[model samples]
Structure formats: C-alpha cells, structure tokens
Target: MTEPIKIDVWSDIACPWCFIGKRKFEGGVAAFQADADAPEVIVEYHSYELSPDTPVDFEGSEIDFLAEHKGMPAEQLRGMLEQVTGVAAAVGLEYNFDILKHTNTVKAHQLLHYAKAQGIQLQAAERLFSAYFTEGRHLGRAEDLADLGAELGLDRADVLRSLNEDEYLPAVRADQAQAQQFGINGVPFFVIDGKYGVSGAQDPDTFAQVLQQVRSERAEEIPA
Candidate 1:
C-alpha cells in the first residue's frame, strides 16, 4: 500500500490568512479525494511566530506591531487590516481585529512541540489557532495555553509544568531553523511530499490541483 500524502504547513496563530487558508486547504482535501484514488492526505502543522519578540504583557493596539514590523503608516495598516477583515468574513470567520492580543507565541510553539510528543500535535495546533484568531484569546500566558492543551487531551499539570519550566524552547527554535533552511519568510507556507513547495495562502483550487498532482506522481512510482 502507498503511504499517505504528506503536507507540512508552516503557520502562525496570529496570521489571519492562515486561518482562512486552513479552511481552503480543507476544501482542497475534500476536492482532491473526489478526483484522485490516492490515500488520504496527512497534514502536519509546523510552528511559526509572526511576532517572536513581542512582550507577554503587550499593551496598545495590534496595529502598532504591524506598523512597526511592516513599515507601514498607521492609517495604511488599518486599511490593510480592514481589507483582510473583509476577506476573513467572506470565509465564514468573524475577525474582530481590535481584540487581537499581540504577544510572543514562542511558548505556544513550545506547547505544540510537547503535544507532538503525545501524538496529538494537529489538535493542539488547531486549538491554538482558534484561540488566537477566531476567539481572540490571549495565547501568551502559560495557564491559558495549558488549558488549551488540556482540552486536547494533554495532561494539564504536565503541560503547565512544561510551560513554567520553559521546556520545548529548543524544539521551537529548531522548527524556526527548519523554516529558514527551507527559505520560508512568511506564514502559511506549505510543502507537499518534501518536493513541492506552496507559498502563501493559496486558493482552494490551487491546493486541490497540487494535491491531485502529488497523488498522481506517487501513484506513478508505486508498483501495481
């Protein structure tokens, strides 16, 4: 039997497009299955922090971070975020940008690493993204993150201990290094089967097409 098609997606919780892209990717997966006879695709979420150095107790608006990081004027930043908010609403996600708490996701990434050890990494990733993007929850605190982990069947005490002790920092750093080595400079980067690189939050059709192509390529290499 052929192995499942593997998709590695690098994304940040704070990235609005990543949430939108995830919905579209799921749509693609559904479409690909309808068009191909390949085994199911297995998606693995990799950690990427947009604001790696943001303070845990950040104050003021999220616009501040965007203006400083992207070198945009404050008014322009609001305009862009407004555009993205419209796009987000179109995808069935309510995005109240004002409630976004910009904070360091390094520790959140650390919890994701710990979840991987327990074989529920994807669950943890989805939860973290939802907490940050959909619900506007603060992901910087260890207690809140531990609660998220617990919701995903992880041991709450252990997760809390890990967060408090700053465990999994090395793993998060390693993930960042891997992203750099792969030439990824932004969120929502996808690599399929270790050969095809899909940059940015592509459309559902694009993801479907890529999945179909990968399925065909793998089928060609397998013996009948």
Candidate 2:
C-alpha cells in the first residue's frame, strides 16, 4: 500500500482566509480523489495565533480592533474586510465580521490540540471557524470553549478542565515555534508532504495541481 500524503496546515481560528482556504483545499482533495490512482491524503491542523496579545473579551468591531492594534485606517480595514467577506461567500462561507468577537485564540488553539488527541481535530477546526466567523461565538473563555466542545459531543467537563488547566498549551506553543522555524508569517499556509510549501488561500485548481505533482514525484522515486 502507498503511504498517504500528509498535509500540515498552519492557520488561526480568527483568520478569515483560513476558512476559505480550507474549503478550497477540500475541493482540491475531492478532485484528486476522483482518480483511482490517487494516493490517500491526511490533513492536520496546527495552531497559529494571529494576535496573541488580544484580550479574551475584546470591545468594539473587527474594524475597531484592527484600527487600534494595527494602526490602519478604519476605512481601509473595512474595505479589506468587505473583500474578504466576498471571497468567503464565494467559497460558501458566511463571514459576519460585524458581530465577530475579536479575542485571544490561545485557548482555542489549545482546544484544537485537545481535539487532535481525540482524533477529531478536523471537526474541531470547522466548528471553531464557523463559531468565530459565522456564528460570532466567543472563543477565548474556558466556559465558552467547553460549551463548544460539548456541541461536538466531547465531554464538557473534560474540555473545561483541559482549558482551565492549560493541558495542551505546550502543544500549541510547539506548533507556534515550528511555524517560526518555517518562517511562516501568515495564516493558511500549506506544507505539502513536508517539502512543498504553498502559501495563501490558493484556488482549487492550484491545490489539485500541487497534489498531482507531488504524487508524480513520489511515483518516480520508487523502484519500478
């Protein structure tokens, strides 16, 4: 049996592009899987906090947060967010930035790590992105995270205890350190087979092409 291709995706729950990219990547996977000769693919999500210093409960709109922290004009930020919202919509994601609660994602990242241990990281990632960008759920506090975990059928007490005790904090930090080593300064970065690095929220075609290329290269490396 051929080994499966492992894709390590570095992204944050607060990142709008990450969710869009995820949809595109899934599309690519579907396209690739249509071929009977296609290899198996495994996707793993990693933690990458965009704003580590953000307060757990931030006040004001997304624009206000950017204006205050990034020092960009509110008008420019609004335009950018509008464009992002449109892109997200194109990928079948509804991003409600107006009601988005900008908060520190450290706790959320830790939750992802916890989910990874339980073999449900993919579901956890989707829930978090939806909660943050679409549902406008608060992701910082332990109580809120515990509730979200419960919605996923995870043990609410265990989730709350994990968050409160920071059980997976070390794993989150380790992912961050690895991202730093890779010189990844942005979210939605894709590391394909630990060799090819595809940045940004690329189109489905782009992702499919990359996967095909990787498969071809691997095929050539094997003794015929």
**Top of the candidates by TM-score:** 2
Check candidate 1 and list the clashing pairs. none
Displacement of the residue 46 alpha carbon in candidate 1, Å: 1.5
Task: Please give, for residues 139-182, the per-residue lDDT of candidate 2 as tens digits.
Answer: 99999999999999899999999999999999999999999999
* Candidate 1 C-alpha lDDT tens digits along 42-118: 98878888877789978877798888778889999999889988887886777777888888888888888899899
* TM-score of each candidate structure, all chains considered together: 0.92, 0.98
Model 2: residues >4 Å from true position, as ranges?
Answer: none
For every candidate in turn, the CA RMSD to the true structure comes to: 1.7, 0.9
Q: Lowest summed-lDDT stretch of 10 residues in model 2?
A: 29-38
The residue-level lDDT of candidate 2 at 58 comes to 91
Clashes of 1: 0
Model 2, position 32: C-alpha lDDT score: 88
